[model samples]
Target chain A: MIEWSHWLPILAMLPLVGGALTPLLFRHRPAAACFWAVSVASVTSVVAIALLLRLVDSGGFSYAVGGWLPQYGIELRMDEVGAFAVPASLLVLLSLVFSRHYVARAVDASRVSFYYALVLINLGGLNGFLVTGDLFNLFVFMEIFSVSAYALVATAREPIASLAALKYLLLGAASSLLVLFSVGVVFAMTGTLNLEDAAAALALSSPMPAGLALAGLATGFAVKAALFPVHFWLPDAHAAAPAPVSAVLSALVVKAGIVGVLRTLELFGGAESLLQPLLHLVVWLGALGALGGALMALVQRDIKLMLAYSTVANIGYIFIGLGLATASAVSGAMVHAVNHAVIKSALFLAAGAMIHRTGLRNIDDLRGLGRRMPVTAFGMAFTLIALSGAPPMAGFTGKWQIALGALQAGHPSLVAVLVIAGIVVLAFGIRVINALYFRPPARVAVASATEAPASMWLPVLMLTIASLALGLAGTPMLEFVGPAAQSIYGTLP
Target chain B: MNRRRAGRILTAVLIAALAVPLMYGMVQLPAPGHADAPAHTNVSAGYIERGAELGGSENLVTGVLLNFRALDTFGEVLVIFTAWLAVAAVAGTASNAERDPVPPSPVVDYVIRLLGPFIAIFALFVIVNGHVLPGGGFQGGVLLGAMLILLSLVMDAETVARAVSARSWIWLRATGVLVFAMVAVMGLPLAGYLFGLPDEPGLRQVLTVALELGIGIGGGAVLAGLFFAIAGADRS
Candidate 1:
């Protein structure tokens, strides 16, 4: 019998190793590279799903790297939080499948293999980040994904891509430095890099440095999560990248920031004095982000830019749920993270397909695409409504739960905020739907455009179905992540 | 102009406000080198005590880096490799037509050539002696990279490129991640966990040295690749 715990490390390693070999083995053959990358991601997805199943059956487990106990060496664990690898790997796999035909035009020929390699490496980093129990390892995995994401943004052929990537790189580097510095501070205080051990130590430590570390980590992760006031870099970077890269960025990458924040909350669970103020502040910031991001998204002419802003809006909703610190609210936030990832990636890929076919990105220009490309347009339209938190769709479960939790927590104003944001989101969704199905073709590109290939539409279609299915599955998901929220927050109201 | 100046002033004010708490936090941390500081007593003490016997290196740093926290080192190595991969993907290899028109002076060229062999040997020494020495794969690899960069400065990049085929160069660049991964997996059967150094002393030593050499060569190649990508030596 296999010691299934061993699979945890391999979950991260397989992709990293496979990615490292992609360019070496398929440098000259991009089609082969796509096949190779998809194969590796598929295998990784299998491993991730298997591990998640084991976690469900057996509860959470840990694997100490090199046989050294957690205190002396790194530990990789699979809790409900780490079970995020399942969706993350699945999303990357779909994105890779979508990339087969997309990259042929979106990226330069010689760099195709490198594009696939970087995406795989980014998944590897994200998976590693989700599983690792060591603080420094968290920082390392963050860099691996971050560096790849920066480069992935630049892989687009647009002239603005380089500047956007540079902006992202600079801000990302600053955030990473903050995280590393905080890690240093924690290490100095606790002398142990293990998250559990350090958390125990921090519970009893002096407040000043502990508060600083908490502040640094919260701010750093907030920036990465694109919380309001620090989300300036996201719109440009996400909007400018190739569509599949954008999907990955807006979907899995930013959620890693949320995961980071969750880990921070777990680390400081015992330090309630420091957490309360931060939580209170983030709630208002989240409200601002929810409103501001929705309004910005509504006004965008470019379809991709609108989607990018919507990501910020959704991130805002998740943060609000997190900040409320109620059981339902936190679980709602966690479930919403997964739902938003599914819905947003579906939206991005469908948008990418339209853009790929017509080379048009403006909402007005993509008018009448409904007739020209039925499947892609419908997927986009369905997911768009789902994205608006409409009932019986993926977005509704989390928003409703969050609103319930807000009222439960005596923050009725936040429920109003959630409703207003939802309505604004629905307004944009209607506008886009009207353009696609009602408005006549206004541009030559729209009139001439055809549906994208099966590779592209298949993934979009799958995620579109998933967005609805996940909504129906919401109760179970909330139940699943219930323990995780409880464990991370340590007795939430 | 007044508004811009006011904005600058506001920025400075905010930064200063931020720095006050940061500095205060720094001051409250246990002072450096304090005998009882957690940095000295907790995990570090364990590493100091048993690192040589359990971690399989006389140099505690190497023991920790290679045996105790080997996964982080592997990640660091992958990070470097990914850095080169990213640069190559973004900027692309420079076309041969874009090569520098200026040629190097004979004196500088001769001096670089003279120093190259010794630098290479010293890098090998540092890497191989990492079990007992301060300098290991990363440091030695950096030296090797510097030598390559120096050579490229004086010699034709085409000549340097031709020394190894493009395919082989890529494999060499991937050596660190690949070899580290291989050793890590080997530990599953031999030492009962991923990234574990084998309990057999002789075999463990061999695997550690192999990891150092792989990382050394791989890091050196990736650094040189980054330089080439920036300098436009990549024809592909």
Candidate 2:
């Protein structure tokens, strides 16, 4: 009978600690390594669901280790925000687990353990980043996650992987530097590195420096979240990474940055009037990322690269909701984050499995996949429908909320951009779906062109189920996200 | 296998095995209290303080890093992490291991032979004394990493790898984060904050020292591992 609070930390650590120990224990046993890794991840998923239940019943709880107090020691402050990320992270982590067999077969045998370790660390980093209350701790966790990501992307040893890793490394380093400088500036001015304390300090201080600090933070987070002008590293990096990594990267890592920016805004926005201008800029940038990324995706021949660009486009929708900054809009963004994580992770893993089966990554080369690999083809189709914001899907509910928020905000221009972007998204989505499912088989089916093994398809199935479940049964979720959105925008007055 | 060589290697391994844990375990011991005695606020206020201060600087650590003791931390640790990355990237692209041309300089070699052990000891002292003194673990750990790097450059990559394996170094790096997270998470319950080390002077100092040891191990290992990664790239 483990206490509920203990479950929260354990859920984050099980993957991480398991990752660190995997190589030592199973360096010689790939099957055993996969079994253990999946077990850890599955347990984490169950724990996350359990933790969410505790949150619903108890509201927010803070757990301190070594009997230390919040002001003086480190803590895990689990609030509505922390609760919100649990299901999403669990869904993604489980997908990574489900994709293990596909990855083991597709990737080098010697690197299998290392790959699982990186996945576990990525999960731990994401969960820790979401849950931690301290600013510096968040940065530390961000580095762990980013470092693991850099290596995971380059692990394939493809030329493109190296180039993408280098590109991501440079941008990631720049983002870290910007964040460090901003943290330093904020600490110097406020004499506190805690988010809530810093928020109060900013409210009391003059606007000029505080505004500058906010700009530094926003720009840094924007680069991580890969919003329009700062999103150049995303396509190459995502396209080059191994499939499960791509799913986690696009679905989860980028959202962590969005969470960071949202947290910053929540703590500091109330007292500052300059935030409105910032919100305006985000709206425009979101519009551009959506339109530009979708247009770019339309021309790509590589399926992975095309999906990567679509990620940039999907990210734009999130920013648009965030920019709207209304209760419903913010809730929509939160919901979208969870929805995208599930759908995108499922799609990428399915794409990876397809590639694994066929030994091809290009759209043209993927002909007849639907006939040969029905499960993957069908899964990808379901994901595409969700990605396209089709009805009766997770993506639709999020977009619906964004559209409603835009209407409430009286921003017709933003609404027009959203509508146009939606069309572009639908266009590219159909282009890929057509190439995947409708295109005739150019080559006879090989024995390899079957549905992925149960391990790989299981998580994909889970994510697909989540996407549909969230879409169909969102009343509870909508209610759950409401208090969180209120915390961000303070219940609209 | 050569008997004498095996015996020497055995001896070296034994020494390392014993020494490494001793080094870490020592940092876990109780630490001294924060200095309570008043000192001159400005450098010009005292003779000893004057020489330690930068001409225009007010903050001591910033002054030490940017001015007087700058080469050790800023120049050595931070710059070296950058240099390792640079070498790794360039050498990785060249598809060859980059080699240094000159042999070890006798003068510098002799100096390190005499002073290396003492210098490492002094660096540890500074790290442990950070609360009362100006220097902290980051600077000290960099110095330690620099020492390993120097040995690697003067001796060989194999020697350095033998001294501390890359696998263990990576573990050390992770351990640093785990330790920090543990300490911070520990603070969540009673302290109402993360990493809020108790104000009881003795306990606080002890905690700080433990934290420093973790940092030192982590920073040192990262520096060593980065070098190994870059240097080992030649094999690929």
Candidate 3:
């Protein structure tokens, strides 16, 4: 019998191969392409879920590609971080289901198959990035997902989409170059591309090159994650992409950057002197991003832009938890990564459904849509509240833990930033909710709009329910990522 | 204008500040090509010591690329394919209405035609001999792609496109990913791991050659497809 560990590589390969065949087999038949893409994602989700189950049952495991040892070849490992493939696959699946209707209008008909193909390829890249233990493989998978994401941003028919995509591509390419350069640096210093082996070597190597690698990696991933000070490329790119595309970008892609940082921390875990200052600096950056992103979101007119800035704010929260380097803080950050992904995707998809039905994107323009498109409107309103850190919802769990962590770390002032940012988040959420429900219909489309099709609203409703469920399951979720935090940071405060 | 100039100056100053530590880090690294350098002493030493016997190819680079770490190469191949997909998805395939106004010069066209067959032969040799020689799938594929582009430049793009059907073109472009996937799965049952080469020398050589061919053909087709999409060829 084949060991369950063997399925690890399949988690990534299945989607990649399925995606590669999509355009070949269903170039003209877009509906068939969507069906094929969703089926592949569904299967990938099953494989990822199975791997997660095995990981929980037996702890972490690694598979050597091509039967070579880890030191000599690529290794795909399933750990708590790799378990992220579960949500990544499921979100991509929902987005694909949602895209069946959304893409018909948002993208050119000639490119529908290509769009589905790119999404699948992007998922494959993310899965591969999550599981791989080799430094070079990490860079390769990053490019795979990064390239597809840049292209997906351009698939929107809007006039600004290409420009936004160009901006995204330019920055993304530069970040990727930085990462590749760091990989080269690590190899030069250590002579091994294996993460475990390199980490061992880096522990004994000179500090200067190791520090450079760390800085290069941290900056590269920060750009990808859209952390403050380098986040200028995010608002336009996320806002201009199609809604489902935005959901994937906001939900999974940015999280990959955080994962990259976690991997960097793991690689340099032995070098505490190098990490201390970096950790301290990121806390301030995270605080600035949290407050600044929330404030920026509060002022946005475009609904998607608001959601985009909200993502930046959530990323800030995650970073703060990471920077604290306490058990509760780091675990809270990891849990929040998943929670925020679900909440953000729900918001984007609901916003997408509204735009699909009414062709309006302004918060004020969507007045009184609650009664007209009840399911989509309710999903959006509910997720928006949850996004603002309301109790018994996904956002609250992470914030509460992160706050407790701040006090534990003796950084009580950071709690003020959290609270103020949370309030600003709530203010914007309430503003959108008020316009959605309390105000009178201000546009003809809002007054006349009907509910979106089942394909669109069902995913939104499912994610809305998931956001609530994940909140209740927060304790167990925290425990699940507990060991990961310890393993990544060596020892927490 | 004054503000822009100030911004540029500030950017320069910041870059210079950043460069100081970067240069310090670079200068501290062990010199390249030294016997004691980590690059020479670590994992590569093992690769050099036993690669021919265990890695299944005489050329250590190809052996490592196709055997030891095939997954990275697979990702690289997919990246190339995705690049073509992105181009086709974004800019779209060329329409019939848009055509090149200036025709190719007769002399240049004839010379390209004369050289195409020889280039094709050379690329195939490079691809097939990759296990022992310096050239490999990527190098050979680039050559093959350039030949196709050269042919397209000299001939009517439509006539060149008609060389293969629209349906066939996509399959050709996907050859790298499909074949790599097939080989990867086959490895699980045959060699007990994904992407493994069989222990049998003949079978391993066949699989390696097959991989080189797939990557070469797929990469060349995708490259030509990219040129066609950008140069206003048939929409296929």
Tell me the TM-score of each prediction against the true structure.
0.98, 0.81, 0.98
Residues A381-480, model 2: lDDT tens digits: 8888788788789888887788788888888776677677777777877776787778876654433378777777777777788789889966677788
Please report how far candidate 2 places residue B142 from its true position, in Å.
Answer: 2.3
TM per candidate, chain B: 0.93, 0.56, 0.93
**Which segments of candidate 2 are over 4 A away from where they belong?**
A1-14, A27-29, A105-110, A443-448, A491-493, B1-102, B106-110, B113-115, B123-137, B164-211, B233-236
Collision count of model 3: 0
What's the lDDT of the predicted structure labeled candidate 2? 0.68
Candidate 1 vs candidate 3, DockQ winner: 1
The candidate with the higher DockQ, 1 or 2, is: 1
Q: Model 2, B100-194: lDDT tens per residue? A: 55878887777766666777787787666654566666777777777777767767766667765545544564454445556545544534433
* Residue A463 lDDT (model 2): 76
Q: After superposition, how far is residue A345 of candidate 2 from its true place, in Å?
A: 0.5
Ten contiguous residues minimizing lDDT sum, candidate 2 chain A: A65-74
Deviation from native of the Cα of residue B200 in model 2, angstroms: 8.9
For candidate 2, state the interface root-mean-square deviation in angstroms to 1 decimal: 15.1
Worst 10 residues of 2 chain B by lDDT: B36-45
Candidate number achieving the greatest lDDT relative to the actual structure: 1
For model 3, the stretches where C-alpha displacement exceeds 4 angstroms are B1-8, B93-98, B234-236
Q: How would you encode candidate 1's per-residue C-alpha lDDT over B9-94 as one tens digit per residue? A: 99999999999999999999988799899988999998888889999999999999999999899999999999999999988433
True contacts kept of each: 0.93, 0.02, 0.90
What residue runs in model 1 are displaced by over 4 Å at the alpha carbon? B1-11, B93-97, B101-105
